[model samples]
Target: MQVHEIQVRSILTRTGGFLREGYSHTLNPYRGCAYGGALCGLPCYAQHSVWITSGRAWGSFLDVKVNAAEVYRSQVNRERRWAATRGGLRIYMSSVTDPYVPQERQYGITRSLLEVMLDEPPERLVLQTHTPYPLWDLERLRALLPLVPDLSVNISIETDRDNLGPGFPPHATPVAERITALESLRKAGIPCVAVVAPMLPIEDPREFARRLGAACDRVVLDHFLLGDGSPGGLRTRRTGFPSKLEEAGWQQWTSLEQFEKVCDIFSEVLGADRVQKSRHGFNTPGPGRCSETTTR
Candidate 1:
């Protein structure tokens, strides 16, 4: 992969599109993702974002924002001074790239950003990633809990099957590993969310729901049809992802029918109050309402 260490003028972007309703700002530490070649990248919405991709292949390159933390500190401080209210600074850690991608270990960009947040904490902060790398910052997360009123770690586990077979890039973190990471975060007293986003083909919904019910504080169930940002999943449909599922004899998995079935199974196992769907699920009001589930 081509790696470029670059300095960015600003780190916090005003949240827009699908995420604007819940988050005020989005923080992306990098321009490209290391896992862009993996299975999840097949239907990745960010890959289609030309503004971020800059005419480059999704996983072929990574532009590290080496000055992310510094920029964040300056922006947050300036925003706080001019903001009309302090309660509106809800920030999503990442939308375009994984904050804890493999490059994080070497650069510690994500970690540095979190450290900066401890001093200038947002009203709410959501850290989302499919990798288990967050486990490396357990103590840092714990320390930020009291400072940030609505802090949660969202881990995505789209399917039960670890291996999606040939033709797909191998997954960086398997389903089981992500579940284990969720369990560990929950055990550490962190508010944990399991995101089954753009639901993939599952071997058993019941078993999968059971695993998530036990591992996370709540579950966010999503299908590409509803969660892919574009109306009716047009963005995802433009990719070869749908044809791939069909080739695997899992055509049924490509529809909302399976998404609803899995949602029901999750609700049954985790209780209706703990299960949320689509955009509403993602916007579920923070850790304070752990028992509340948004169906709309």
Candidate 2:
């Protein structure tokens, strides 16, 4: 993989589209995620974005936003002044990229950004990723909690199977490790959730929900057809994910029927109040506020 240290003019971006309902702003510390080559690569909506993709392979390159923390500091200062007329900033960190990728250990850009947030904290910060690296900054995250108590870290676990999928990337963290990370984070008093986004085929829906309920505070279920960053999950369909599922003897996973079935089981096991659906739950509301509960 090629690494490029690129400087960005801005860190916080006004969010729209699927993220508009829950988050006010989005911050991505890096461009092109290291885990992009996994099964997610097949249906990754971000890859369809011309700006970040730049016609390059998804995992072939990583652009470290070297000045992300510095830029965020200035942005937060400005946002604070602007927020008086509006409301507290609900920022989703790393909407398009994973903040705690392997590069983070060396550069600490995500941690640096968190340090800046500690100084001028937002009302709510949702940190999302699919790896165990968030444990690396547990202390930093714990410190920020007093300032932004509503902060949440969502660990994306697409399926319960250890194989992940038929053609998942070898470098991606194992399914069991992610579940263990969620348990650790929950035990550490960090508000966390399990995101079954683009929900893949699971061996046992009841077992998955039971495990997630034990690990995190709540669960959010989604499927490729519902939230694949396209009008009709066209990007995912074009990747042949449906055909792949059929060939793998998991054809039911290609349809929303199975997704809803799994969601129903999760609701039954975890309770309806504890199970959120689609992007609405993934982008939870700020502190002292109630988000409109939604399902799909």
Lowest lDDT 10-residue stretch of candidate 1: 287-296
lDDT (Cα, 0-100) at 158 in candidate 1: 89
Candidate 1 lDDT over 1-296, as tens digits, reads 99999999999887778887788788999998999998888888788888888999988889999999999988996665544353478888888899989999999999999999999998888999979889999999989988988999999998898877777777768888899998888878888899998788888899998888888788898988898888778999887798888898889988988789888888888889889999998877665523224221
- Structural RMSD, model 1: 3.1
* Model 1: pairs clashing at backbone N, Cα or C within 3 Å: none
TM-score of every prediction relative to native:
0.94, 0.92
Which 10 successive residues of model 2 have the least lDDT summed?
A: 287-296
Model 2 Cα lDDT, one tens digit per residue, 1-296: 88999999988887788887677788999999887877666666677677997998887789999999889887886776665454568788878888888899999999998888889888878898988789999999889888985788888888888764455555367778888888788777787888898798899999999988888778888987888668777878877766777887888888889889999999999889889889777766532212222222
Total backbone collisions for each predicted model: 0, 0
Sum up the clashes in candidate 1: 0
Candidate 1 ranges with C-alpha deviation above 4 Å: 81-87, 289-296
Q: Which has the greatest lDDT?
A: 1
